[model samples]
Target: MTSSTPRRDTLRFITCGSVDDGKSTLIGRLLHDAGAVPDDQVAALRDAEGRLDFSLLVDGLLAEREQGITIDVAYRYFSTPRRQFIVADTPGHEQYTRNMATGASTADAAVVLVDARKGVLTQTRRHSHIVSLLGVRHVVLAVTKMDMVAWSQDAFDAIAADYLAFAEAAGLPAPTVIPVSGVTGDNLVRRGEAAEWYAGPTLLEVLEGLPPIAETARPFRMAVQGVNRPNLDFRGYTGRINSGVVRVGDAVAVSPSGVRSHVERIVVMGGDLPQARAGQSVTLTFTDEIDVSRGDVLAAADAPLEAADQFEATLIWMAEAEMVSGRVYDLKIGARTVPAQITDIRHRVNVNTQEKLAARSLALNDIGVCHLSLGQDVAFEPYEVERELGAFILIDRLTRATVGAGMIRFALRRAHNIHRQAIKVDRNQRAALKGQKAAVVWLTGLSGSGKSTIANLVEERLTAEGRHAYLIDGDNLRHGLSRDLGFTEADRVENIRRAAEVARMMADAGLIVLVSLISPFRAERQMVRDMMPDDEFLEVFVDAPLAVAEARDVKGLYAKARRGEIANFTGVSSPYEPPAEPDLHLRTNQMSPDEAAEAVIARLRAARRLTASPPFEQPPLT
Candidate 1:
């Protein structure tokens, strides 16, 4: 052992492989042999075979043992004289790949297991690729059940070579491959004579001999978690140092704003510290009273964090709902939460073949390269530069559940170049001249649901009353703006996107824009809502049952869709996700188009978008 190098107390690692690969047995043997298990637990270790039946795993995980599945991640603890270790036992099934990523996110190393009979399976490649993506520094490949193969070195060497090649292509570090029998406890804690041909170190020796992380190599970076102001005199910023170190008098800067200051004091719980390194949560007081907020980042002055509003990232879709391009989701990056959208999906990776395949969206457990546009500029770095600053989780606005994970590769080259040009006459000024609050009245529902008729009536009434107004129908847009797009999922998303943009432009020109379209997905409508400010966008759902709409197929489109002539027709082959809480709900089934138009007019008046009354104070339509 290299005693000169400082050792860390715990090595957080994980055991991951295909199902029935002896991951549980390997961990059980290691824990028992390392003297981490209690005598009482050992008494109940074996099954009817008088052998270690590690078929049962971590506590609270026995409920799944009957099914021989690990649905969630289970953390197990063990120790040796050299160092203590925390091992995450992760599920290996394909559906639970997200759970595996959860365990590997914080792990320093991964013990990738492979059954001697199965060699390297798809799960092996996927787990290893995720490990590489998550920045796990080390890997120890344990080929378990060596007794099944009679401890053949040739089989081990062949499997090792294949895995090494795959890992190299997948951007993973070369792993240490060892042959071991989890059932017989061979070559786990000590070397047995089974594989005399193998002259390398045993499984435990490799892990014990591996060097602990002893580098504070990156520039200092700490995202301000909160502004600490207990009393009047003490106003310090509290956060954990993500990298490097900071001491008193050290020059530092705030990100996204180039405000520089010097560290006056570093205070911990007990007292002030001379200096604080990575992993230390300390309260820092600066010499100058600088502008700081919850989402701000404090960093070394010479190496301040970069800020960007657009980025290129790799996304791992975890939610069952497929990822939709042009949809707005909340992306939490370190201390900051920003409204983010996947502007484009460049491609998705085939984990087994390591091939890049063209894709419009990412499904559950699918990995894709995507472009993200944030609502505002944020301090961040590439994943290779710093994990804490580069990694982010995507949250659904409605459900508030984590839907996806992303690693920032780099900011888009054009993100820094393209800046918003200022216009002297802005939206508010234009709206003031028109004497109305310019807004987009979006009408959404099934096809042939009277959306277009209501929108037309509303447009005529507004224009007749001397208010400048515009109507953008989805079918009319196909004539030019979205002519090239088709009826596929991606095409529909683009169609809606184009209509929303046109509505936004018309609203900017001081016109009340009325949009009539069957923007199928709720996410697509939400994207439009995000594009405009509050009170400037009104979602008017022309509610109608699918059967009612199909019966009233004025354009015969629904009849064609039912005949299987149209592949992705919404309400037939494709799905239409209705708005859960629309700003104005007009049930077309009970009300005529005239009444629906009147209701929309009333809503517009109530919302103050239109200060003028209708053409002649029109009576209720009969």
Candidate 2:
């Protein structure tokens, strides 16, 4: 007399595969059979033979419809009698890694499609690995277009075997496999008389019976998004609990600070709460007046979060611009944003082959293991242990674009081992001893722009006035300081980093450091500027036209660059990002080297950096 009732829980899943693997078709077909698609839409989607074009239901973008390929992530909400579904039809193209990542970031489960004829592919492996990284709890291998292969059981078995092996190696859970044909509507929502050898539940049956995503039981943790001080009467910390549970009177501690506190009230919009769990946003009032601020994490008192400034992580490069080591980027983990740099790309991962390859830089869609160095200590756990505290995004500092996404593997041991040594003497002391303010004069411009000439003149003038100024020429740096560096954009970034560090060190030693380099990128120069004190680093733009600089190239560097001999030559091949607002701009072609040097000295005097130096006499132009 009793009949089984179907579960009604919603499942968020993504459909991803290599291009033309029938990802869109499979989704559309599923929706159509489930009776989720409107009759009008289905009628409009019919092809010449009166057969429904199942791919049209999800590929809603104009470009996607024109090209018949899913360009963007198309999210569709549909439900069968068994279960409700939120499906993200992700792109299958190679360059759409960013789009795939965006969709995979939130999905609890993933449906990886494979063409029956094509078998397992490179991108199939890549998407599988990414979804695994994003913590997709469940996976289903959808072998689409089974009708194309005449519903062959051997072909389905072979593809399943290949993918399962790869999944094991790539640290993914074994996926549920299903053979389904979009055209025939076989083995998708119902079992058609196509493959009697296959004896498994339909795709819909497996999905309906699947268990809910379970979060691992861990110590309570929440990154404080802000302190809610509505008025003078009440003050509470506000954030979503990243993991574990929190209750009133629960013993808690602030991380990286180790400050102890107890929860007084779990405040929500409805009023006081006795308890709160992970993923719930609430305002937590502390028993004590704890010195808690944004970017700080609250955790269980007994099990505080691990604090580190260096970590080895798996990075997925999502930007068009290649990822270069030693270039600083903003690492946004939870509510915390810190200046972080990929110190070294340990190795690039071959997603398809699962091989480790040597790599200095990672291009778009390249996955690599990188050593990250942060500006300050941050609270975190390994990504395997917890997703919320470990996953982060790399932001390009200048553009503020999210360039990469990474997951913390673990903290580097040496990060805790090395501490800043306490010194008796400091920068101010050294500057006072020298009786002049320490500074870095960074001269940026195109090559053959008389930067070295201007630097030499300025240094000579400063030294004559008893100012201990040091000149760091670009050519001279390559021979020693940056000998290992080349002219690639990544290399150029590192080169400027080394030069700026050396200049800072010299400046700290009470020397007026004059650094003359064709620092092409404005972002790199900005990085150098941020390393110094306010107004202490003077950006001097040595201006010169491309034709003038090329004509003035005595070493034949520009000619070689133009003739396809020398690579990454500034003003010839490589781009030069001139400073938008320079402390001083000198037209090298308009002024003699002496005049340019005098102008710099004048600017420094005006800024009070040349307090001890007298006015320099400019030599007459020949």
Candidate 3:
């Protein structure tokens, strides 16, 4: 323990699958083959008799023992002369997906087991998708129970090909697939006669040959995990160096405050060191008196670091509730936790086919592209460059539960772009000048059914009353702001998304904004609501029967849609789901336009949205 140099040859791997996928048995076989298990444990397993008592080796939990399945991620430490190993046996059930994510979060590689008879199931594809999403670069597709299929090469090859195709379609990096029989112990530790036709290294041989991570080539970055104060004279910042190398007297910058400092000393727990590299947990002392604290990261000055309040990222939704935009959560990155919200859902990736789908909200176990706005600027690197600093987890603010995992793709605002702009009036000042608070009035209705007309009328009235109002008319916006957009379900969703976000910015500037378009989807409207505050969101359902809307079709869009010239056009080729409940619903066919406006204005006043409206004067009874 006192040696100046500590042994640094540990391989962290995780075994993941759905329950009854034989994860425990595979782990037991590996431990037994590697000679890592104690002699007593081996003897017990051999003497236990009946039904392959392999569970006795690692299933220490009483629930696991009785239930005959792993309930939690079990960690087992073992070592061979060449390398040390830490294996995490993760649960395979759908309900335990979070547990599997936890177990595989920090692993350098993952071993995904598939039952030979079951071939590739939904869970198999799910686990593969998860492994890739979690940034596990190396994957070993271990096809278990080959003996059940008589060690048939064709069976193994077919499964392998299917999995490979699926994985490719899912955008997962290519994985190495190997067939093995855990029960008979063939091709686990050594090559066996049962797999004579199989021409690959045994599992142990492949594992042993896995190259260790190249820690030195990366950029220097160490997130301050905690402060160490052994004594008054020994105050130091302790953290694991996530990437690159740090040496004494090396110049480093502390982000996101961007404080420049030099390393005074590097202190390992056992001894003082002149240098420290990635993966080493050491305490660093800065020469200058700087405000360095937990969550701050030290990085090389040449490359510096990326710190941003907004970022574009890829997220894998793990929660049961769909990922709604603007919902605040605690983002845990490295050793830091910061408030964050999903500003937008760019698109969702189909895990099975790797196709990008326009998604309003990400469902459970869905992976998607999202724009995240952090409460404060945070230091991050792209996952491709630095896994430790680039990856983060989203925790529900109230429940303190981890809901999603993410990887930063690019910083929205970098350090160089942090300079203050030269503007006379800022956003707050602009809001104050508008008299009435700015907000988005998202109106949804069928084509030619008075959405645009009402929106334009609302904006005109608000402007005439000295309120700074803007109308992001759906058609007009599509010609400019959303010019590239179309009318498909996805395109429509995207169209509304762009409009809502722009409306939010304008509203933040104290304008009363109105969006008038035929946004016929309920989900799309809900997405807009999520992007704004409850009071700020005003959903007006312009209720008109399809017959009326088509009758008044000045653009002949309804006729075109009926003629199959357009696909997914609401109320003609596509289905239009009416709002079950809305903040304001107006039957345009029965009421005059002025009466409808007055009704909406009355509701807004009741909600305290209008500034100068007299105390709820009843309109003259007609």
Candidate 4:
């Protein structure tokens, strides 16, 4: 005898597409027809003009109502006699694409809406690709607003064929196409009489019939979140099980350390459990006193996970600041955190056309294939195999803000191939050979703040006094090394990174290196400070108010910014963070350029950065 598949009781899904695709209306209609909406709440959905507006039900925010658009992901719960449903109505605007990704991250299915009049748009394709990337196997292409097209079968067939072709090209599972009018309730609850010739299941029928996604059969994995010891009587490791099942006597291995142990007991809120399955929150008591702490993964001993420090991943840049290669960030997966960097960008995918485009950096909402190198080995699995162990977020270390989301593909072999090479000639030897202390004088300020002028004067004064000095001006280097970069927040970070690296190299060669740049972000400046020894880097804040800098727009850049001809311009469109406690502060309004140079020279001498044995002479102020 054959057995029948079990019926799923709950469905999790999201609605996404281009702006004004009737997603809100479709959800509101579903809730209303299913009697999910209360009578009093239904009465409250009317606008000031007293029009029957369904979208007012879910557009709950004041900003959303005023703008007449959804800005954030809004979740709604409703149920039918056969099944319960949780719907995430994600914003369709291009700027809020990150929020859509966040909503789709946990969904088992997706309802991608498309306006019958608009057909398939760029956002439609973008949302489809994201749903596929997130592992949502079941998809519904809701061709909404069928009443506008007179319920024409030809129009519906054309869109369905186009989407199927796109799905094939993008390697996404084909979606079930449906013709419905969300506003008029055609083919929504029960098939309306709008289309007489068409005979298909209603939207609710298709949704209720979708099978529940099967749980992964992979070996047990749990990230240790906390060590619980109410008293000396008992000790347990507390965390939510990520995959598979664990029993009381199950043998386990701690990853990244390779420690082996056996579970003695499993404790839950109710009591001790003989076994715990995936998604259950429980604590386990170990039979042995092995070393285990937070940020460590405990897995089934039979199938230990791979420990690696490097992997290739699909990255989605989420910050307004673009992504910069070679910059370290906090890579957080489950409970573990490691310092990581995107070493290289291989390519970016064009969502609208499904084409691969070469890219060096990723901007906001950009998806690309990149290489990540971690500070230490971590237990990981490919996202296709296990989501909790493979999905991660990139956090800006200094700002303590999330900047990107990534899905690990696989570990790379070249990670172990690269090793640090040591040399006999160190910094001390290089400094001794030049007969002077090596240091980097970092100058930061707003545009036209006299930083470049003061830096040029300081370098000239040092060179005339028989000392080796070099000036790494920001603008001059931009014409060469950073020529490919722009004024986005991410590019600004890279610009400073390249300049600081060059300055460090010159300083290592036993020369005084002066850097003049409008390094606006405090985080970037602090990163540069942490790169060298305590006394080797000095931050000089060339102070000038925004009014003063705008008045002295030497290149007419500020004027262009005010006229909307330039964007991300500091003190205009973007922001500039001044140093909180600079090593040297120069108020250009109160001191001449020569006076500033002399003050810097005096400070260097006091710090022992210059010795008198070299027969140094001070340059005249004139």
Name the runs in model 2 displaced over 4 angstroms.
1-10, 38-50, 78-84, 559-565, 611-622
RMSD after CA superposition, every candidate: 3.1, 3.6, 7.9, 6.1
What is the TM-score ranking, best to worst? 1, 2, 4, 3
Relative to the true structure, candidate 4 has a C-alpha RMSD (angstroms) of 6.1
Error of 3 at 258 (Å): 2.4
Model 3, span 1-622: residue lDDT tens: 3587567587889988667878898889888888888777677776435355665677788988888888788899988766778889988887777778788778888888888888888777777887887778788889998999998888888889988899887767688888987787788887879888988888877777788888889779999999888787877899989889999999999988899988999998688898989879999998987888899988998879978878889888889966767556789888888877787889998765667899778888777899987767788888767777888999875567778988888886553477656878665566655555556777888887788777766766665655667888887888898899766666676677788889888887777778887877665666577678788788888989999989998999888888888888888777777777888998999987877777766666677667643223333333
lDDT of 4 by residue, 80-148 (tens): 877889999999998989989899888888999999988999988888888877778789989999999
Q: Which candidate number has the best lDDT?
A: 2
lDDT of 2: 0.88
Q: For candidate 3, report its TM-score.
A: 0.68
lDDT of 4 at 8: 38
Clashes (N, CA, C under 3 Å) per candidate: 0, 0, 4, 0
Instruction: Tell me each candidate's TM-score.
Output: 0.94, 0.92, 0.68, 0.77
Candidate number that wins on TM-score, 2 or 3: 2
lDDT of 1 by residue, 1-622 (tens): 5998566577889999888788777887888877888877787867788766654546346556777777788888877778778888888888889899989988889999999989999889988989999999999899989899999888998899989999999989889988998888888888878888877788878878777765367788888999999999989999989989898999999988879999999999899998999888999999999898888899999998899999999899999988878777999998899899899999999998899999988999999999999989999989877888889999998789999999999999889999999999989888877777898999999998999999999988777666778999989999989999898777888789888888989899888999999998887888899889898899999989999999999999999988998899989999989899999999999998899999988898899888744334434444
